[model samples]
Target: MARLREEAERVQAALGAAEVQLERLGQARETVTEVLAEPDAATTGQARPR
Candidate 1:
């Protein structure tokens, strides 16, 4: 019973970490989507200086 409890705790900790990673990935996807939705600099005739 103690071993089972320890396994459960480990699984819970891993799940928490996974959730945080997922949230960060979701935010990154949102940022990329927003950037892609914007007009392209080339098309707008406003080239970005490198």
Candidate 2:
């Protein structure tokens, strides 16, 4: 019974870590989507040199 409980605890910890990783990946996807949706100045031929 103790071994079973330990296994469950380990699985729970792994799940928690996976959830955090998933959230970060979701946020990164959103940022990339937003950037892709925007028009690029260079592509529009309106780019100015710094």
Candidate 3:
């Protein structure tokens, strides 16, 4: 019984860590998507040619 409880606790801790990592990855993906969706100065014809 004690061993089972310890195993469950360990598994829960690992799951929590994995969830945090997944959330960070999701946020990073959203930031990248937003950046890519925005037009740069060149694409918007706002850049001066050298």
Off by over 4 Å in 3: 42-50
Q: Which sequence of candidate numbers ranks them by TM-score, best first?
A: 1, 2, 3
> Which lDDT value does model 3 have at 18?
100
Cα deviation at 30, candidate 3, in Å, is: 0.3
TM-score of 3: 0.77
Clashes of each: 0, 0, 0
Candidate 3 local lDDT, 1-50, one digit each (tens)? 99999999999999999999999999999989987887787778886444
Error of 2 at 39 (Å): 1.3
Per-prediction TM-score: 0.79, 0.79, 0.77
Clashing pairs in 3: none
Stretches of candidate 1 off by over 4 Å are 47-50
For candidate 3, give the lDDT of residue 15: 100
Judge candidate 2 against the unseen true structure and give its global Cα lDDT, from 0 to 1: 0.92
Candidate 1, position 16, lDDT: 100
- In model 1, pairs of residues that clash are none
Writing each residue's lDDT as its tens digit, candidate 1 over 1-50 gives 99999999999999999999999999999989988997899899987565
